[model samples]
Target: MTGGPATPPTPRPPLGPELEVRRLGRFDYARARDLQQELVAQRAAGEVCDQLLLLEHPEVVTLGRRTPEGAADGLDLPLVEIERGGEATWHGPGQLVAYPLFLLPLGRRDLHAYLRDLEEVVLRTLADLGVEGERREGLTGVWAGGHKVCSIGVAVRRWVTWHGLALNVSNDLAGFERFRPCGLEPGVMGRVADLAEVPADDPLLEAHLERHVRGVFGHR
Candidate 1:
């Protein structure tokens, strides 16, 4: 291979940032929360490196830390209170949920920037799937054609972040129609299947998202 002038390689995130990924097909909400609690403690105590949990819940609605009053008044699903900061969102089959039990980057402990990074991951993933995903002003999740395809509600404890992002691949949208997520109007959620011609298998998408996230964070 010959070149007139060699192009400089692109700079990547610092390597060797340990990341553990767990993919449980269709897991429980409460149990996953408990597992996150355990991992957070372990991570803070130096017992574990950065960890990422990827799974889909069986139709559950989580009330975020900033969710408004009566946000989920009449939902027929279990209402779980979590430490994440955002409004309510739904998790169910066909969506990809990722919780990164990570140690915030040294000297750059900015939560807002981290949230934007999460959005970039989802957007890139969508791009790889032949879909164009963008960000909406005054919103935290990734959007496509003015509809939300991914929802992010993050919470940090001792600079260790948890409660990550969820991307809709092919989930049943009826659940989202039941509530106003993030104080946004109802019926504004979307899925990758809606925009892509490829198959929206959860496991396949989960694997792809994991790869995208690993590269985005540059965790070894």
Candidate 2:
């Protein structure tokens, strides 16, 4: 009776790229963005291995490529303009933001395929937490019971991805009302805690996400 199919979903073929996962707890939004920029360049140049940057940002609103002018007009949170895909979205404590600095190899340069892979990882992670997540047709994030619990928007530079997805865990979702997220109504946003029983101090959310990412992408 969860959100997705009763039977387990099919596993995706693992990309098995070497990945370095870094957890930066309570990081600043601007600083994290800057770090991703640096890492993307390094990864593109083969100076560093592919990485998965996991962390939470303080309250901030970001405008992506598809965001309309003044989309963040009335939000009191610090606003930042970014190059990621999608519209305005919020990030704060209790939400996990993952920036995967992955350089697509010769045969894996398909953006659509990469996005679906990310969705699958989130779906599997939700399953681990007893929350069944599903994908809405033409939508980019994972949803449970018709509410979107994750928001994904990525940008690629020289086939290396930077801006990535954010999964709402226990964040204050009131700020989502200030603007549309991915051009959808504010009420469309959902959190894992709302659907599953997540202990306030539990580390399982992050652990599940990391494990699923590695499992789906075949990363070590």
Candidate 3:
């Protein structure tokens, strides 16, 4: 019941020479962030392979490092400034957050390229469900029509990366109304259920997301 009707059980990619997956649920951003920092330190010390920490954050609006003043204009939600890159966005239950901690060689640290690959993972998942999407110019997420279906904001240090993307599954967008999502034009946020014309809890949707994620990062 993981992959949707259109999604096949695709083969997982080999995580090259270093990669790990830490499955967690219902975790807060603060704890997740702490784990990310710890994992980064571990990788630096060669104590563990690069890892992907998956979890859901409590309802919160996070403003990234480069976010400008008023980027969250008109939003009344609880806000927290974090170490990630990009503008402001919301995270809550029902949404899936992925934090990939990897070490890229100095010149190999391409943040833009990394973001595109992450977007493609979501886009491909959506495509399998007959939902076509594209990357908008000057924007950092996957979009269906004009609504943002996935949000991307990442951070990099010395060629290592942490804090990845968030995809709205069945989360309440009402909370999104409290802010201009990712500092985009108001009302630009969206969910998979909204575009797929199906319930977010549909067994197929969950399966597809999990499979797609495994597929995306399976290759280290």
CA-lDDT, candidates in order: 0.79, 0.83, 0.72
Worst 10 residues of 1 by lDDT: 1-10
RMSD of 3: 6.4
lDDT of 2 by residue, 77-178 (tens): 899999988888999888989989888876677677778778888889889778888887677888896799999999999989888889998888897987
Worst 10 residues of 3 by lDDT: 1-10
lDDT score for residue 130 of model 1:
80
TM-scores for every candidate against the unseen true structure: 0.90, 0.91, 0.81
**Model 2 local distance difference test score:** 0.83
Candidate number that wins on lDDT, 1 or 3 = 1
Ranking by lDDT: 2, 1, 3
In candidate 3, stretches whose alpha carbon ends up further than 4 angstroms from where it belongs are 1-18, 70-76, 197-220
Residue 1 alpha-carbon offset, candidate 2, angstroms: 28
Q: Which residue pairs come into collision in candidate 2?
A: 16-218
Please say which candidate is ahead in lDDT: 1 or 2: 2
Q: For candidate 3, what is the TM-score? A: 0.81
- If the candidates were sorted by their TM-score against the true structure, best first, what order would they fall in? 2, 1, 3
RMSD of 1: 6.7
lDDT of candidate 3 over 42-158, digit per residue (tens): 876778877777777888889998778987766666678998877788899878787878776544455666676678778887887788888776777788866887888888765
